[model samples]
Target: MAPEPTSPVAGEQQDRSGETQDPATYEITKPLDEESPLLSPTRDEEQEGLIEDGSVHHDRDETSETKPLWYMILLTISIGGLQLAWAVELSNGSPYLLSLGLSKSLMALVWIAGPLTGTIVQPYVGILSDNCRSSWGKRTPFMIAGSAATIISLLALAWVREIVGGFLGLCGVDRESEGVKVTIIVVAVLFVYVLDVAINTVQAGIRAFILDCCPSHQQEAANSMASRVLGVGNIIGYVAGNIDLPKHLWFFGNTQFKVLCVIASLALGSTVALSIGTVRERDASLEGPPPKGRGGLIAFFKQVFKSIRRLPPQTRKVCEVQFFAWVGFFPQLFYSSSYIGDIYVQPFLEANPNMTPEEIDKLYEKATRVGTFALLIYAITSLATNVFLPFLIAPSYDSPANASLRAQRGQHTRLSRFLDHLVIPWLTLRRAWLIAHLIFATCMFSTLFVRSVGGATALIGIVGVSWALTLWAPFAIISAEISKLEEVRRLRASSPDDNNNNNTTDQAGIVLGIHNMSVSSPQIFATVGSSIIFKFLQKPRGTPGDHSIAVVLAAGGLSTLVAAFLTSRIQDEVEIPEGVVVEEGLAAFGVLSS
Candidate 1:
């Protein structure tokens, strides 16, 4: 027999039922069918109550649960602000390291550290949130606290820079005292790293929280919204950071950055609060801290480890693919900017020897702005693709297909075999698109060998446009397809004749987290690995490191085709679970025909 329902769990459902008789005293006349929605997705929440075999299971419909749209918008804005500040700092804050005289190698080391945290740290945070229990809700407290830390750290970084300058001055090393300032700068950098970790903690929590609230059928739409929000936020943040204040250069320094930090903090805090405030926390056992003891930490880890280990086979498969995909993609995170600077900017200057350093700097800045714009274009295009791709799958829009579409309501498509042949580019072109992108990325990266601004500019534009055309949409499409398959599985379980209508909600967060991990893990590996590789290839030390890294990037692009091919193998595994109506219908049709 399953464990008995705890008091907290009983009380929550009581409240949900609007002051009804105590759940303990209530009669369960209706059998809890597989299709009946759980009060919460976690498995433990499902076995609380069951009715006699003849009873019809009536679930409190999942559709009623939604955090308001404005709350979601606020979350989006907050995240955008944070991303914007980070991007600006990533681009401009480096002057501090250079001015303080850190070696290029050391600077790279510091840069590598950020991605390092993303690789392991984020998943840990995500897992923690998954099991977290607090009256304030599992994720919001972390979100608010992390935002506070980010604001404080951004201010501290600027102050640390100024303090180092002053200390060096007092020590009588006024001019070219960069070497003397390394220690102070390093300390500040360490602080910034702490801040980054905190912010990422909140980001991970927010993602899990979003999954927690959205129904399985709605996940694809939610994921699409997430992509759009991220892209929009980044674009806005970048544009805001790039705002040139000719009238108040002094204000634009630390003061301006500090102000932005405050705004970011407030935005995140408000958004987090709003996101959770109106939404009810259903799992009462999760409403307070875990039991106190030294074993608590150990127990927590044990639980998390079990959660990971016990993941269903499908989830594990997704994790493996994610890991490989991330590994192949990591190099681009650090290399993108460097690629622009070296392949285009430096080459342009070197070839135009007649131009002065000042002239080159001016031109390079212009070129970089253009490059940034290209990236923004790519971001927007990606958003559009994600929205439209679902319609093209397997005659989803055909009138006859509407029955399957409605039955798979949460699945969000009109047809069962939406994967048959894509419309816009055609479903058959899916693998081809993946191959083409890798080729594009490789070819674009190879342009580092080109020595002309004009050629480089043209190449950047092409790559930017191509990437923008489909990057966001492809993932959305793939995720939607898989999610729809999962939805079919859930519906099959809901059938009265089936014994396995399980609430599979817990899998969604972990799956999405793993998906993020695939994307992030590569960033970590690529950032560190590429930096190390480029270190050997740096000018004067090694021969044409920029070109070499580009070649490697091109290789990575080619490798993505391998991932694309493997995706086909994974595709067949994403079918409706056994005894699902879709599968049963097909079987019955086969029997009748025979």
Candidate 2:
């Protein structure tokens, strides 16, 4: 049987030629009221209206499905390698200059550069991917290209270090001198930063891909799958780093590291393959073909500004929270290792002044292993919280199918409602999760006050506990929110006469770009700020200086708390009608476009 139209939209509509047309036109600009993400149009305009029409039993067709468990594991392992490498770089590179004997001042420059690039790179790439049109498809091309670029960049970085050493050997420069090695190190670090941007661009694209392919109800599983894969990557990368491959293998030096990078590359490639192979997808027929206009660099910037200006208020609020959230997240991700190294390794070295170089290296290795152990715990906790916790929280545990059915009907009362009999308490719990996330940020800020190796290690280790909670809760909440937003948009678009005006994918990508900025911006601030405190300010020159580093970390943590409060406003924003006036006063300096 043919699907009926949502309204009388199919009977008489004009074509692009401006004549009374035969086919229904898809205009997507309608405001979605009380929308839900689980709902999607079956086809283009005609199919969309059919789903919207009450004539058919649309709810039967709108039910959610889950990806197989094995597929989730496989996909996670393939993708996790890159994150492992990322963790290594973040942890090791934070104190990279110190390891290379560069003065703290010079090392600061490298740290400052890492997150600065992220601030500029991730959002634009995310937005572009949303609008891209090609034979290969939107995201795959970016994924393939980004993976290839990341591989080349990593190889260049490893080789660059070797080249510097060889050059110093030829020039008769003191092999161990700070300047000779520092220059070489800085160059390599810069290259790594550039490559990292490319890799993250691919990562952001992959994230958007999740939002694109997975329907609203499946977002939790999708996000869980992503987190699991990240854990797999971390395990592989850390295990590889822990092993002294160079001592036993022929290519243990630069070659061994190169091989590991290659493994990461392959792993990232595998993620692309799995996504392409396993997930069903559809083209955004609404965007039409890619436009013919080719803008110059200046024109591109102009377009970016224009795009930013036109974003709706709810979209803008998401961006604001992200901006604040990333300000905390990035620094922690990129600098945690370095912070650990500085606080623990450097202090131990000073205490045992006569310790051999090999001993110092050994101690550093031990600390790293400890950190990795903490990370493993964190990953397990994240998986448990995100993957398993939701399953238990539904209306009741009669059977999985019945529970899911109850959730869909919104008739089944869950634990929160049963206990409190009020929505406010449940909402407060959600608010508290964000508050805890901010409090965790404060723990990061407290690092500036830490002076002893034990203190630093203990704090960093405890961080895993809070981290598990934050990652699980926020991700679960955000996934649900996005689903709600998508549903609302789809419903509005379902209006029989509504023109497909607002670019759904593009708008979504823009919001995600802003969201990722929360992840990226903090890296920029943390690296640059820490560099100033550790290097230029010369605070860590002694015990007193070490305390200064802790202070900086504490400030960042406090900022996280503030962000948690701000996240509450976003919850309210989510309930507002789409394209409506976003509540004012919450607006930041940037003007929000309608």
Maximum-TM-score candidate? 2
* Backbone N/Cα/C clashes per model: 10, 37
Candidate 2, residue 243: how far the Cα is off, in Å: 4.5
| Model 2 collision count | 37
lDDT of each: 0.46, 0.52
Superposed Cα deviation of residue 148, candidate 1 (Å)? 1.8
- What local lDDT does model 2 show for residue 83? 77
Residue 500 error for model 2, in Å?
6.1
lDDT of 2 by residue, 1-594 (tens): 111112322344444466663332333222211111111111121223323322121231332333456644543443565575575565555444455555565565666555565556666776677568644445656766776777777666656667787788899887667777767777787787778787777776666666655544455455656665665566566566555555565452434455556556666676667765665334443334443446566755555556555444445555555566655665555555545555556656567667776776567666655555445444555445444433333211022333344457564445533432322323332454565576578578667666665666666655654554454444444554455444444443454554454323233455566555555666666666766765544643323234444555665676666667777775432222222221121122122121
Model 2 regions more than 4 Å off: 1-79, 165-183, 239-263, 283-287, 291-294, 307-315, 346-351, 355-366, 388-429, 445-455, 465-505, 536-545, 572-594
Model 1, 305-340: lDDT tens digits are 544554444444445544554444544433444445
- Write down the TM-score of every candidate: 0.67, 0.72
Q: What is the lDDT of residue 509 in candidate 1?
A: 38
- Specify the highest-lDDT model's number: 2
